[model samples]
Target chain A: MRLKCPLCGDRDAREFHYRGAAKLMERPEAGAGEAAFYDYVYLRENPVGANSELWFHELGCRAWLCVSRDVSSHEILSVELADAVKRGQA
Target chain B: MVDLTGLSALEGLLPYEVDGAVLSAVSYGAITSIMPFRGQKTAVNVRLKADGGAALPRIGRVSGPVAKRLIWAGRGQYLLLDLRRGAAFDTTPDPAFDELAALSDQTSAWVVMRLEGARAQEVLARLCPLDLRAGVFKRGHVARTELAHMAVILWRRPKGFEIMVVRSVAQVAMRRLSGAMDSVAAQAVLGEIS
Candidate 1:
């Protein structure tokens, strides 16, 4: 599979390291309690259809990307730099 | 105080040649990495223009003259390669734009190799997965990719290709590239025979 990096254009998936779900984008506050922290750290949704993921462009731009893909078909729907996503720019 | 002398990582194993390719070490004096601070790209470009007579290069492009080339390494990152032998840039960030950009010396971190020949593309195709067909990856293009599991920065030149690998993996890089060169040359020989 190939991913189109926002800055480096399209690249082979082998150059990227899959970093799991993009839910890490949202973190519970320090005072949000034990269960909140537990859910944030360990509870993962077994997403089946449209899924958002985090991938590191290990060999290319070294940018963290938030990828929205169809889990069942492996079709990539969108790719954005994690920085931009975190900044609400993308 | 202990005295130290700098030696090339591939001090004796390079300048290798075969029927179709030549692999040799490049003594790139100093490589400086320039990373613009967030929202300071324009300011950094202004400084770069005033300093090097060239602006920051676009993604996958190279700018400036052969002596002091600026290569786009990744998003907001540029590598300044001082090609003049014995010339070195300050490892510390220049005070001119200390806040606009972050500068770091990469001379000791990377080892460069030049591969040029009639079959240079074939030799590289055996290891790198990039599309190297003529006109596709034209001159002045740069890409960060892998060659034989080792991360490498590849730059396309008018005559051939320049590969930059980490210093620690220099030997493995040479071994793999030379092996590819031998394989390509052997394939050509067999073709000629048949």
Candidate 2:
């Protein structure tokens, strides 16, 4: 299957791995609590609709992408990067 | 003992899983000929039935040929040449790829598995992340890539993709793969060309 890369536009899925979803949830920092870190890393919401996620192109360009996909059909709706700084805005 | 400076052996490469399915590794060495069918390799992978009968279609075929005698024997890749023939490599009427293809076809007698099912794609996805959907990996196609931390030859069959990982890594791959498929289990020995 082919995918529209966030940085390079459309490329084949053979070049990228599906890491899934852009969960901005962050850990509560060190000493905040082990349970908090565990829950944040392990827990995930498997929504099956238009959603955003992360993908690493390990074999290709090796760029991290924030992809908007339809989980139900595994169709990629759109793709972007997690780095807000790439947009150069506040 | 021939001058084997870097030739590797494939022993203990295939290990039996607790559930009883066998995983294996093999090596196809030497650069003999190149056969590309529809841009795919047709190396037949099969499994035997509980009744010792043939079950399903061939796993894959070899499109590009690398050597003459190919062996799924153990855990490593082997490139064999008939050194007995003082004939130079690939300078004869009968090419190396043709001979290897015959050997690959004869192995059809060996029971093999299609390794296909609902989660077959999922199992493969965990290995190479190639997005093995319907359109991408179609029947009669083949790919040589790294899977489950090992080099593997994958064939796209009608039923499911058949793959042979490094025999030494078979056990580890099987364990890691059990978690990939949502389907409960897979068969022990799959048959061929049925």
Candidate 3:
């Protein structure tokens, strides 16, 4: 599948590596307790429908992307720069 | 000071030619990577124009003349090169752009080459997956992509394309490009008789 990089345009999927769920972006506070930290670090939901993911464009623009995709159909719903997501711009 | 000899990555393995395409090593006196400080892009562009007679290139574009040009490397990153200068890095930071952008000399970190001729596109199509048609990938367009599984920055020049590969894999990149050239040339020869 081809993924459209916000900066580099459309590129083959081989150029990008899937990091994990987009939830990886959220980090617990230092005093959030061990259970909360453990859930943040170890628990992952394997949803079958629309899922937000983190992908790194290692070979193209080197931008971290937040990709919304359907897990069952493999259709890419939308893509945004992770930086922009963190900044609440995307 | 010790005497040191500067050698290009493809020192003795370039200037290769096929039936219609020619590949040659390209040397730059200095290659500087310019990445603007957060929210300083406009300031950096203004500084670049005042200092180099060119502004920062947009995505997949180049600024200035061939003698000294700034080519877009990726999002918010650029490579400025002096084509006529010696192959060495100028480590000094220029006050003109230092505060607005992060500058680093990258002269010896890459192997640059120019492939030019009528059939250069055909030769490159075999290795790169990008749609390189003249209309699609017009002149001054650039892309960070893979060429034969090696990361490269490919750009369209007037006649052909310029490819920049990491210095460590210069030989491997050369071999892959040369092999593609030969394959394209042979295909052309076969088409003539059939």
Residue lDDT tens for model 2, B1-194: 57644423334433322232233333322222222233123331121133232222222222222223232221112212221222253333233334323222212112222355544665566566454687966654554444665545566655566565544555555556554442223332232111
* Per-candidate TM-score against the hidden true structure: 0.94, 0.32, 0.95
TM-score, prediction 1: 0.94
lDDT by residue (B8-33, candidate 1, tens digit) is: 99998889999979999988778989
Q: Considering lDDT, which of the candidate structures 1 and 2 is the better prediction for this target?
A: 1
Off by over 4 Å in 3: B86-91, B192-194
DockQ of 3: 0.77
Writing each residue's lDDT as its tens digit, candidate 3 over B19-99 gives: 899999988777889999899999987887777558888888888898888899987789988766533645555767868
Order of candidate numbers by DockQ, starting with the best: 3, 1, 2
lDDT of 3 by residue, A1-90 (tens): 988899988889988999999988888888999998899989998999899999998888788999999999999999999999998942
Worst 10 residues of 1 chain B by lDDT: B84-93
Candidate 2 structure quality by residue, lDDT tens digits, A1-90 = 667654434555766777754664243678878887777677777776877778765443355777778878878787765554244433
Residue B28 miss distance in model 1 (angstroms): 1.2
